[model samples]
Target: MKIACLQFNPKLGEIEKNQNFASGLLESYKPGDIDILVLPEMAFTGYMFKSKEHIKPYLEDAETGITIRWAKAQAIRLRSFVMVGYPQIVKGNPDIYYNSICFIGRDGELIETYSKHFLYTTDESWANEGPEFKAINVDSLGKVGFGICMDLNRYQFKAPFDVYEFADFHLQQRTKIVLCSMAWLSNNDNYNDNDNNHEISTINYWCNRLSPLILNNNNDIGNILVVVCNRTGIEDSTTFAGSSSILSISPSTGSVHLLGSLGKRQESIMIIDVPIDDDT
Candidate 1:
């Protein structure tokens, strides 16, 4: 099977422009070129907003909003399952919103949705905390779990490092694939030759956070696949770290293989061919 991570910079509040930019990135690929396509959190909508009132214009419905509309089109056009994030307005209450990501089937039907379980400072201003993390089964992929940007961090950045809440849940669920959509920021504001190294640091931190699953006792199954789709570019005072990558972890040997990755400043798609365990 093939997996793709679309890494690009999205300007604040420019949904249509970002959509076009992302679309142009995938133009070279024919239908079925990718089995699964992942986009960064708030994929087309810029990540930073001051308040609920500030983001009202960009809030979208889970099903019929402009974001989903765009995702569905990509899913159908590429003949691939698409996972992307957006700011979602609560169905019954217009006042409520969540930083959410949704999975669309190859036929462009909604498969599952997961809101951000851990809110970043920006999310706290206008989004509600989602329920606990969970995994769902999808065709070919077996069991797949989803996570937004802050979900990978230690809870509130205060939880015991060993807790590994997200990784533990997926390990318990025996998830074969973990898809993470992120708008992770660079530690430094100034971009320099060292930016690439900083992106590597972030990726290493992410892997260490999943140590529980990486160090799992189960040696019977194949390596688990984790795909992180992170964006690049600056939004106001924040500069995003864009080293989107696909990793394969061996449960038996505790090895983490980086299948492919994009640079911190590259606006491109990283595609990797992965071997799926049919019985997993």
Candidate 2:
């Protein structure tokens, strides 16, 4: 299957602009050529919207909202499934919002939705942390796990890490692809105007340190493939260095392959062909 990862800098609180940008990317692909397209966390409304009230009008229902409807149409038109993140208001609890990743199947069906299990400190003020750790299944791709930005960092936590570890073990027992959506930030010094020779070294260190964890786990139970899409640009004094990529793990030898950086703070789509095997 060919999976595309979209790495881009979204204009903060600009939903229509972001959606238009996404549509342009989708238009470039031929029908049935791409199987899945993964987008970053809060792709619709960029991270760090100043007010919840301001951001509220842009929130969409994962199943039937205009965003999903447009995505569904694109999925059906392109014959590809889409996994994109957006802020959603939970039904019956209007006051509380959730950071959600919605899965739209190739036929435009609402397959499943996964709310972020781990919310960053900044997100805690506006969104509720998801209580469930569930995996979604795609027919050609096998069972897939969905996680947001901070959820990756949660692997360092004991209890949540245990759960994630087990989830990895179980997915390896069935599938090969694990999908992640992120709104990640590099160290502030890396992007500062006054250049420091050590800043480049610092950025590389942080990227190398965190990148591999997305591909192979410490437990070594599964040889999984990771497709991560992250946002770029600065928000509220925090700058996201968009180095989103696809990390592939060889099931037979556990070898790892890193493909595409998509450049910092720019929008682009990366396509990778993932091979599935009997052992994988």
Candidate 3:
């Protein structure tokens, strides 16, 4: 299946302008061009808001608002599934909001809405944490999983050192692809404070964080695909890491490898294909 991962920068609080930018990229491809197209977290409603009120105007009802409408419109035009992130007004509780992702099917149907189950400190002031993990089935894609930026890094402990959270879904489930919408910051974003230890690239951070699935050394059917679409450019004190990547493990060797990368600071629409096994 061919997947397009769009990595671009978004202006803070300018929903109309940002939607146009994202829409332009979606319009660049035609129908039957790709199986799925994934955009960055808060694709239109940029991250780094100063307060909850600052983002209030952009929050939409998770299922039928502007973001969903846009996704439905684009999915209809492209004849493919679309995954994007936007500020979501909780369905049953309108007073609550979350940083979330939505999956719009090729037939212009809303398939799923996944809230960020784990929140970063920066998000706490404006967003609520989601309650559960999720996996869904798409026509040609098989079972797929969803996660936002911080959801992938939900570590169990950070007391003195660090302890990783266990992610065992892929081993037992039929999920073939996992999609992550991110606005990941570059490590060097903290350089002004003179912390030399914070120089690792976010791509390295992602590769390591995905060890539970990619490091399938002893597991069979190891070819699970992880598609990440992250934003670029600097937002306030944070410079987002833009190395959107598509990585996978080789079924033959059970070793992890990079299938594609959009690089660190460029705005791009990367099209990569993942071979689907007949059995899957």
Candidate 4:
């Protein structure tokens, strides 16, 4: 199966513009080409909102949100699975919201909705922490895990996140693929989206983090694939990492490689075929 990741820039609070841009992107592709399509975190809404009130205009209920409606329509039209991130105002009287990802199946059915587990301090003011992650099985994709940007980082609000380690968790679940959505901002002045070196290092950093769990000599998790959809461009002076990519690791052979990638700061849909038998 071929999976496509979308890397793009979104302006603050310009939901309609972003939606149109994303819609136009899908229009260029035939539905049967890609099995799954992933978009960056808050793909339509800019990620730098100061408060919940500041972003309320873009928030919608997970069940009936216009964002999910668009995704459902796209999935039905393209005959592919679609996953995108947006702020979800959970349906309730208290009006609770979270940084969330919604997955729509090929038949336009709501598959699964995941809230972000790890959040930055800045996110604490408006967003709530999410539930513990567990991999799920899709129609075509086998065992799959879902995650967000900060969830990759070992820390949560400056502290080590869960009690269990990353390796143990995935190993037990035997999750073969992880679909991730990210708005990975580069706050360091030393690094920007223009530098491919920094972007490569960032990928390397993730590889290193997963080394112990999926691609090491001691482990037996075969053919683990991590597919990332990260945002690009600057939002409120913070530049996002645009080197959205796929990393495949065959634990039996202990070999890891980049399957496909988009250029740093480029807006494009990258598609890569997955060799079912290869375990990196």
Candidate 5:
């Protein structure tokens, strides 16, 4: 199966612009050539939504909403599964919202919706935290795990870590791909007077450090493909350094291969062919 990750800068609160951007990227790919297309978290609206009242109108319902309808149409047209992130209001409390990733199948079906299991400290003011880690089965792709930005940090905990515990529990279920949708920000505060370090070291310190560690640990347990889709550019005071990538792991040896990366904070679609092991 082939996969594509879109890395681009999103305009804050500009739904039309961001949707158009995603549409254009989707149009560039050939139908059936790519099995899955992953997009970054809150791609429609920038990371900081200010408040529920401010973003209420932009929240989408996965079943019959315009965004999902458009995405499903695109998925059907491209014959590829699409994983997109957006803000969604909870049914009971209409006022409360959840950071969600919606999956659209190649057949124009709304496959699954995974709410972000871990909420960022900054997001607690507006978004409700998700309680469980959900995995979906995508026929040709085996079972796939979905996670948002802060959910990756769940691994930082020592005992009974949310992500690690989730991974341990799910390992027996035979998942193939672990997909993450993120709006990764570069740490500009740490760039003061570190002239002694190499340029690569400085870059890696802020941008690329956590990814390899996450991929390495995941690869060791099961041969899973780790794909991260991140947005670029600056929103409010935060600057995003786009480094979206795909890493493939060998089940037997746990060796990782760098499939691809989009190094700039510009619009890009990265495609890579992923071979499925029949033995699994």
Candidate 6:
């Protein structure tokens, strides 16, 4: 299967502009060229809203939101599975909202939806915590686990570092693929100026966070795949750590391989074609 990550800087509160920018970036790929396309958390709507009232206008209907419309269009246009993050208002309840992600099948239909189970600082300001970790079965991809930016971190970043809630869930479920959309904050603000060090650091940190699955590699684990699609550029005072990547962990050798990755300042898609070995 071929998977692609679209990484770009989205202006705050400018949803239409961001959507056009994303569409233009994906114009070159012909339909059916990409098997799966993933975007960063809050891919178009910028993160960092100050409060619920601050993001009120941008909250979308869980079933008919603009983000879902865009994702569905892209899914149909590319003939690929599309996953993106957006802020959602629970149906019939404008008072409740969640930072969520939705999956669109190749037919432009909603396949599944997952709200962020772990809220980051920014999210806590305007969104409610979601239910729990989950894995959905997509006929084409086997069991696929989902996670947003903060989900990979320790619960509220206060739990034992070794707990690995997200990775552990996927391991227990024997998930074949893991999809993560992130607006992960950058530790170094100057990373865009040809400073490759910080980008490497971020990638390493992510790999380590998911090391549980790598270390527990068994025949059942075969070749577990992970797609981390992150955005770039600074949003107000916050800068995102870009270096979106695709990786594979081989159970037989207990090894992790980097399939492809984007740099800190790139505004493009990182695509990789992975061959599945069913027999392990």
Model 5 vs. true fold: TM: 0.83
lDDT tens per residue, model 3, 10-94: 9888878888987886676898788898999998888998678988898999778887888899889999899999999877887
Better of 2 and 5 by lDDT: 5
Give the per-residue lDDT of model 1 (tens digit) for 89-195: 98999877999998999999999888999999989998999888869988867889999988988788788777788898889899889999999998667765335
lDDT of 6 by residue, 1-280 (tens): 8899999899989999999999999989988689999999998899879999999999987679999999999999889999999999998777889999999999999998899999999899999998998898888789988999999998998998888988888888998899999998887776454643327788888888888888884865578899999988888888888889998887667778888888887888888988877432
Candidate 2 off by > 4 Å: 155-175, 188-222, 251-254, 278-280
When 2 and 4 are scored with TM-score, the better candidate is 4
Stretches off by above 4 angstroms in model 5 are 155-172, 188-222, 278-280
From the highest TM-score down, the ranking of the candidates is: 6, 1, 4, 3, 5, 2
**Model 5, residue 51: C-alpha shift (Å):** 2.0
Candidate 3: stretches off by over 4 Å: 156-166, 190-200, 278-280
Q: lDDT score, residue 257, model 4? A: 82
| Cα distance off (Å), candidate 5, residue 225 | 0.6
List model 2 lDDT by residue over 1-280, tens digit each. 7888887777877778888988887676889678888889988788886556767887776677766777788889989988888888876678878888888888889898888887786677678778866676668777777778877654435463234543344344454567778887766525643321222332343334334434454444455666777777677778886767776655445355665456665667888776665323
All models: lDDT? 0.88, 0.70, 0.78, 0.80, 0.71, 0.88
> What is the per-residue lDDT of model 4 for residues 1-280, given as tens digits with 9 covering 90 to 100?
7889988898888888998998887788887788889999989987998887888788978878888998999999989999999998877644688999999999999999999887866567788888777578887777888888877777663545433345455767888888899988654434444554337866776676676554455454567888889988888877777789898877776777899887667877888987775443
Q: Deviation in angstroms for 143 in model 2? A: 0.9
Local error of candidate 1 at 259, Å?
0.6
Better of 2 and 3 by lDDT: 3
